[model samples]
Target: MSGDGEEDASLEFTPTWIIAIVCTVIIFMSFFFERFLHYIGKVLKRKKNFALFEALLKVQEELMLLGFISLMLSVSQVSLQKTCIKESLMLRGLPCKRESPNSVSHVTFVRHYQTNFPLDFTGMRMLLASESGGSGHCKSMRDWKSWEAKIQQEDDTAEKMVKHVHELQFIKKRFKENKIFSWLHSFGKQFYGTITIDDYRAMRLGFIMMHYKDNPKFNFYKYMIRALETDFKKVVGISWYFWALVIVFLLLNINGWHAYFWISIVPFILLFIVGSKLEHIISNLATKVVDQNAIAIGNCVVIPSDDLFWFKSPKLVLFFIHYILFQNAFDIAYFFWILTTYSFGSCIMGKKAYIIPRLVFSGIIQVVCGYSTLPLYAIVSHMGSRYKKAILPHHMHETFDQWLANAKTNKLKREETSNEGTVDKFWGAWNRKKASNKTEVVAKLEEEMQEVQHEPVPEIEIGIHN
Candidate 1:
């Protein structure tokens, strides 16, 4: 019984299965929830307050973006933590071995007896020292206190260095804000017509909203309508097949197979299938409409409406789907990797301390990764098309140029108005009083001249009549 108890204690918390199950459930729930929202939107469209539907769609998009960012942060945090822990152990000459070197499994710390060591920097140092042949032993409590003080001094120095770096950055920013630099910046913006990735994204979003507004039937309502009209058995069969695939993948994941790769690859296949279907739909619609109405620009055909709808709607949807699915696979793989690289029984900092750093690191990673890749992706995706000659009611380049011209004109007008107001204000009440007196004198002189002319004319008219 004692031996059995010992064995039970030896086994640490391995929550890989839980992570796998939760991720799977989240994926399915998110899909069904989206469908449910679409149904609600359909109902709302019949009401006067259809703005609620638009708000709901915006919220959903924002939430998806937030979720992706969160997932990315989590992956980065875990990866960084794992690296820190491994390096700390190695530095102390401790043995860190995984239970299964080739697969996702828990790590084991060999020749270590302490199970409740703290995860803070000092605690980690002490724990590792103890493990490295009684190096944690000191002559007295005073020695331990001294050692802690030394660590604290080092931490204070590090903090001071960080503060110094921040000061330098602030100084650099102030220097860049000088009049000469500011003028150069404005000049560059005027010359280049400052467009950015965010501008493109905003434009794309506007186009999507316009597309949905123009073609209400081309949305999720169509799918719902089809589902309602289809044979119940066929719908059931399709659903069952989908669920079966999901279950098979989940089982594979549980068995420690390369399920994530399969999951990630499946989205690409679906993207291809969906892309072909969308192309067919678009082609059929094209046949029905006049060629003159649709303008082919680059790789996309823009449909003329109140606003241009870049006709890559299907591709856009497929890209989002693929991105989400790939993210899920990446998250699952990262969790498994982290778990396999670190021993669950090992001491770690309290949740609050651990989480704060992770959050900060995640934010840094998100900003770096987002800015580095997003613009490049946007530019590359929109590059090179054979159909640039199609004349349209409004061209993007012309619109942008007009907007830039208008902005510059408005800025100049504002500056001139401000300068005139400043000059008027500088003269204070003197300028206003002088102007008012001048106007009054002119009015009095005109009145006097008018009276004199009227009196002479009356006498002259009477003599002529006699």
Candidate 2:
């Protein structure tokens, strides 16, 4: 009891322990009483309680970092706990008396992961069966074909699974081809009149040389919008001023603005650097890469638009099925807006709007961006468009065909009415001119040229010399 000294020296409260306790409280509040906290925030905001509102948001941010902090703490403790007992045994990988989470080797962790995740045995087995290249996990997966390992034989269902060893091997083989493997193997047959795994492997060889489909997007504004949507995260972070403001705010909040006012100069320089010509080039580069790889995969072009799902084949049946999913509660943008406004804050400063807050401006921007970003917004907004029978008789291709038809019609009209003439118009003008020349009717052009040539140059006086 005397050796304990009323408790171990490690049990004493420190800054780290205090921080951990605070984080635990915040995480608990965030998880259990999120709505209540928001309500309290709204009430505080309405009453113009600045300090409390700011404090609440600070806690919210702590809640965001809670998971990350917990992970770091666990890892740190595992690597350092043995040092508490003896100085000489301060080795990083020293094991504690109890089975620490760190003691669970990578293989054990992965086994647990494969068993629990996906919540479906078929999916778990399929994922485990994937040939992760040359990793030790591959060896484990290979060993799964053997009789000793029980993972291949175990099932949650009370009904007895196949007891035979060969049956397990067959299931393992079946799990290896989970995705479009059969379909990928069929592509050579569909295109080249050959169906084999060899053909699929051969397709991989031409991966470097494969060409992608490119959209002939003549509309600059529309194309630019699409580009922005594809990589909005990258585009938004281009502003050095935004980063400067963020850094300054953090420094001031952390170390008292007056105490380290000079510390802000560095961020100001960064902001200035961002607005310079060099920063402009970086911004342009980001914009260039925006949607360049949208529909590109390896060297192959998957689809014309980045709006569609990546893995889904661009077939008529699948396209309509995707459309049905779109129609049914695809209000993801609205959800984001609500969370940002209510949970984050109405202002850039994390304060309530009360007046013309940032949320209002952001809402407008979000609506514009979402509509420009995808045709689903338009199709969904237009009620009864889904049920328009004449447009899509079987709904096989669905609103996608309707959208395309409208797009084509608008494109044709733009071509007709645009001030910038097309290739056809240029050729037509050339042909007409040729016909006129052949008919000997070029007098107007000759007279115009002669008039230009014969026109006298006006004499100008220098300063007051005239």
**Candidate with best lDDT:** 1
Off by over 4 Å in 2: 1-69, 74-219, 235-264, 278-466
Backbone clash count, each prediction separately? 0, 0
Runs with alpha carbons beyond 4 Å of true place in candidate 1: 1-277, 289-322, 325-332, 335-414, 417-430, 433-466
Worst 10 residues of 1 by lDDT: 229-238
lDDT at position 12, candidate 2: 57
Q: Write the per-residue lDDT of candidate 1 for residues 1-466, one digit (tens) a residue.
A: 2356535444254356766897899999989978997887888667523334544554455456546655675566446435534534433422233344445323333212122211112222222112211211112223323433443344322322222211332122212324455445433332231223222222232233444445322222222222222211121121234435544543444222334444544443443333333222222222322234333222122232311113643224324432433333333333333344444343221134343443343333233223322222222222212111111122444587799999999999999999999888878778888999999999999999999988854444445554
Computed on alpha carbons, the lDDT of every model, listed in order, comes to 0.37, 0.33
In angstroms, give how far residue 249 of model 1 lies from its true place: 17
How far off is model 2, as Cα RMSD? 30.3
Candidate 2 global lDDT: 0.33
Give the clashing pairs for model 2: none
Model 1 clash pairs are none
